[model samples]
Target: MTLKSFSGVALAALAVTFLSAASAQANDISKCVLSGEKGSVAITPVNEGAITVETALPNPAWWNGDTPDQIADGYEYCLAANIAHRAGFDKVNLVVSSFPALIANANQNKDLAMATISITDERKKVLSFSAPYFSSDIGVMVKAGTKVDAETVKTFRIGVLQGTTGAKFVSERIKPAEEKVYAENPAMFAALMAGQIDAAITDTAIILGQAAKSNGALTVAAQYQTGEFYGAIYPKESPNKEAMDKIIDDMRADGTLAKLASTYLADSWGADPTKVPYLKP
Candidate 1:
């Protein structure tokens, strides 16, 4: 072959290789992005390779296990895993973080945290919330054979989880004769069963699940229509908020969220939250 022809063929091969690599890179970027209200945004992992997801643990049905690695089951775990996958991360780095700590500290450094956090205007001041993934209402649970209602609850010893809407409700609206704040669900439930607290108030799904596991030792007394929705929380003004919101919306639209709820929550919650009687609080 002539020297000129050989040079032309070599250059053509080099151009083809460059175009192929560029196309592959473009496809990869497309896979890494999520588009929503703001526009397309790329999800960058907060941790090295895996997406960091913080959750309050030992929450039966929602987060069944006690530690980070053991939290391989339940609704929130399943949802978190799905979120990581959609974000183009191969795995999720689950970390144990308290519910209050996550809310109070705006610079927690985690990519996302899910602790059944209710989206409230007051909380939005310090944190950015992804679009709501689940909704719940205020619930009242009492020891078996104990009687309590909206009005009567004002006189009972009430137990609430600190830094939660339940605590806010009891303090602001209920004005109960006595109120106790516990850091976590197990502690609060222990106080109720031991008679240290006359009743416990929190999200309907949570108390109902606890009550179901109690096997007649406890019962849900009343529920209020607070119309609260749970969202995945992000650090204040985090750039990834829009991307996570878009991912959640897509999951909802494609019925992925529904499937996860059905698989993990159906048996764990044990009772239908919608059927719980609503009381005026």
Candidate 2:
């Protein structure tokens, strides 16, 4: 072949190889965005606790009703699924283990834990946390007309979601004589309605949502300034931890987080992104 023709052909081959490499890189990112191709992420409830996750349901059309599946489709589950999908995971799996089990599994397997875990300095020592997805304060829910002040409510049988910061707060701060920890918030609320528990302590947003749906059956006794910051928990040494943090930060900057919060937390919960408090490290 002529020397000029040979040179042209070699250049073309080089160009093709470069293009192929670029395309492959782009595909990897796309796969990460679509299927979280690294692996399947598992999120379980808090240790013995039953608070629903923001990612419980991939869709919100079926959030009413008293079934586990229905509750799963409610706000927390849906929110988690939405964020997972947006962050490039093909499918985010929600596991139904207790909160403690979830934490233990994450520690062992290094999977992401998405149950509504509140970020605390003590927990940060054990695991990594994503940016605050939701901000909540501790609140008390009692039967309508229950004559109890916030101080007296601490002495009564206080129901809490098992393995939650609320439960921990009650244990360390309130130290109630009889504390009932349920696997799920709905169960705790049910116990209050049944008179099995005097009052339920939980995130103000969840309790307010429950109260709004209950038609005056329950009332908020008092809302405390516990300053709870709910976050997506991950194993302490997760490789994807930085990536997940970047995605959450990007979402916050781009207003996606605010939009999701508004959809799930309701207007009354005050979904303003600017108003959301960040957890101090």
Candidate 3:
């Protein structure tokens, strides 16, 4: 080949190499399996395992022949579907891990956390939080006839999701007679249903979701005034923080967030649509 032709080919190869390196750098999030639409954020599952909001079956089917796929059509499942849609993503992978691990993994991998992570001053020190996706108060879940009231349940054995605001609130505000820390909300709720604990403490929204699925097998004793809100978590130094924040702000301003909460969380948790918490710059 002539020298001119060879030089042109070499330049094309160099450009290709540079583009590939930039793309790899852009997608460097460890363990983040990017699928579905653009800007999709992943959530860690509750406890059982990964359940896709887009295609998973409902959990509370009344029919004996109902498969897991059939039950995925419940409101809670649709709520997750709504969250993904409002967040501008068609899908979000759920990673099942403890709250601490979720935070740690998000930080270490430089991936955004779509877990049902509550925003608190303590967590703010280590991570940036998107707008309040769901508002929930701490509450106690107990059997149908359990002798527990909001005020009196402080002395009962309470199960809490480990490393969550619910756990922190129980430890600081309401000292339970005994504390059982589970890695995820579902496990804590399961423990309550199984009669292994007197009560389970968690976000009202989550407990309500479980109660809805269990067909009134559980009841909320009382909602506490923790004033907690769940948000999408990101590394403290994430460049996408500004973009994520802007998306949340837009959602809040445009009534998208309220609509999502009302559809998924309002009936069960009484989440106020007007009570979105503002994030700091």
Q: Please identify model 1 stretches exceeding 4 Å from their true place.
A: 1-41
lDDT of 1 at 41: 35
Q: What lDDT score is found at residue 191 in candidate 1?
A: 94
Q: What lDDT is reached at residue 218 by model 3? A: 80
- lDDT tens digits by residue: candidate 1, 117-173: 888998887678888777757899998898776688889999999899889988998
Best by lDDT: 1
Writing each residue's lDDT as its tens digit, candidate 3 over 69-109 gives: 23332333333433444344444343334456676644344
Model 2 segments more than 4 A misplaced: 1-82, 85-90, 106-111, 267-281
Candidate 2 lDDT tens digits, 1-281: 33334222221122222112322122221122121222223333233212223232112221333433435333444444444554444343445555566655444442466655678888778767776655556777789898766457656998998777888888887777698888766678779999999989876656766766678888765766565566777655666666566655554444444444444445433222222232211
**After best superposition, candidate 1 residue 7: deviation in angstroms?**
67
For candidate 2, the C-alpha RMSD (Å) to the true structure equals 15.7
| 1 or 2, greater by TM-score | 1
Alpha-carbon error at 21 in model 2, in Å? 34
Candidate 3: give the clashing pairs.
44-95, 45-95, 57-69, 57-71, 57-72, 58-71, 58-72
TM-score of candidate 1 versus the correct structure, residues matched by position? 0.82
Task: Write down the worst ten-residue block by lDDT for model 3.
Answer: 56-65
